[model samples]
Target: MADSEDSTTPPAVSWRAILRGTGALPPAKKTGGAPSDPALQLWRNWQANHTQVVALTRQWQRIETQLIHSVGFPQVTIRLSGEEEPKIAHSVDEIEELLADEPEAERETLIAAFDAQQKRWDEAAATLGFDAVDAELRAALDKESDFTASVPTTKAASLPGIAAKLSIVIQLGEPSPKDTEFPWPELRSALADLARLASPEAAISPL
Candidate 1:
């Protein structure tokens, strides 16, 4: 469809959820009852932007998962002689989950430790070309890259107008050929970045 009128689109979706998922939803509207009252425009804009962010986020998550697993999330230990190395952590998500049930005092400590670990992970990722991959994706999402050139020009026509449902002649269009090459470079670069993250020298130990 040429617009945000998909029948499968969900109701009860939140603007905040879309924002958190992809950081691409339009900014929140504030103030009202003026020549340009934002409250008057919120619902329509919010839903359209929310759906886009959610769909993009799903694609990013799949690429990330595939890259991480492809690299076996390589990680290792770092220790001076006679100093015990900390447990290796591959994913921030896993580390955070482990701290979820802890008392605040202990959780805070754990979180700080994991934050340090994540920094190291990021550094390692940079060494492996992951930085480029990340930058490319962000640029594409921000529409700052040339990726928009790949958007298909002719999408399917909308459902025909009808007085009664059965009166409209709905022609079944053949499925369009999917682009297998689109976004492949971005995804491939991310795998290399993930490979660098698996390195040991840049490993961060939990305190």
Candidate 2:
């Protein structure tokens, strides 16, 4: 009976799956703040413009995941060059294996679609200020004397790069990183400052 029940359990939904299932999911709960609140307004603004970036990001993620698996390289990166071939690195054997999974024509079509989608994603990210949010957060962090003192130089340098990742993770409704990898408490404190100090028109970028 236990085995039967276990076998019947559904697989967990990923963040990307949730994006795809947005229309089918229950309405999101309202977390109210005063009408004049900057963070609240910014959150609303993000909700409005994030659809394109989110969709493109999800699509690229799927392509990247498939390419990585087919190439037998977990960290393989994929990008499109203007009027040039897509940047995907693999040996002849790996390419052959990738081709075996999907016909050459279908694979080329997929890559072309991804290239167009990625350009749109880039435009949306720029217009929506995803990188700007990272800058805002990093700028806020730099002002904290105690935070600066506590964070090591190497970690401090990497914070800007990871700031966009942090934003994206939040947007995806993913769990926060463990304290061992990132100081969650410190991040929360910095966020508090960011909310309190940010201007009314502050740009809150997403991943």
Candidate 3:
């Protein structure tokens, strides 16, 4: 059967594009509103910084996703000094857990082996550009924290707290074989808080 014309039709033009083509009149300028109003100025700053943080968050997520897929799971094979058989760890977390279970006197040898193997994974992550994206995300988070500090009564005062947690780089080689989680829950919450606080309806008052 032949497909309907509608099925093959291109998507309709966006309302924004249509309005632009029609040459809509420019918005009216404010007559008496004070441009130097501190509350209004703070809100504007919050809005601009929030938008940039949201964009950087998305970019960070995309790069992190690619890095995770490119370097699957990290596994390490370690041979203790006196052990006849070598130990295998699928992740650095596992190595830590293993070392914790061993006696203090015997842990040094095991730790040395683990460190050697871990260095390989760290180098691998660095070579894959994890360091670059990590730095960018940290900088954005720090900027957001600074903006949050400027507004005393803003509803998103917790933005600084959220940024502190998010800025801590969770090393890539630490995830175990079954660890498939992404750091999105707190990030989404932080973004929501920023958007709400930056909206026109939210009140920003001085202390």
Give the winner by lDDT: 3
Overall local distance difference test of candidate 3: 0.45
In angstroms, the error of model 2 at 197 is: 32
- lDDT by residue (tens digit), candidate 3, 1-207: 332322211112211111111211111123365322343344444445555666767876776676557654355566666789987887556667766756765566555656765575567667767677678778877876775566554332233222222222121122432234554444434433432343324332211
Q: Could you tell me the C-alpha RMSD of candidate 3 in Å?
A: 15.3
TM-score of each: 0.27, 0.23, 0.40
The candidate with the higher lDDT, 1 or 2, is 2
Ranking, TM-score, top scorer first: 3, 1, 2
Task: Provide the lDDT at 32 for model 1.
Answer: 55
What tens-digit string does per-residue lDDT give for candidate 1 at 68-108? 65543444332223547555544555545554554667646
Better of 2 and 3 by TM-score: 3
TM-score of 3: 0.40
Most accurate candidate by TM-score: 3
lDDT at 155, model 3: 33
Tens-place lDDT digits, model 2, residues 53-123: 45555555565455434433422233333435544533334434444555677556545655555555555
lDDT-based ranking, best first? 3, 2, 1
The runs of at least 3 residues in candidate 1 whose Cα sits more than 4 Å from the true structure, single-residue gaps closed, are 1-37, 74-76, 87-207
Error of 1 at 129 (Å): 13
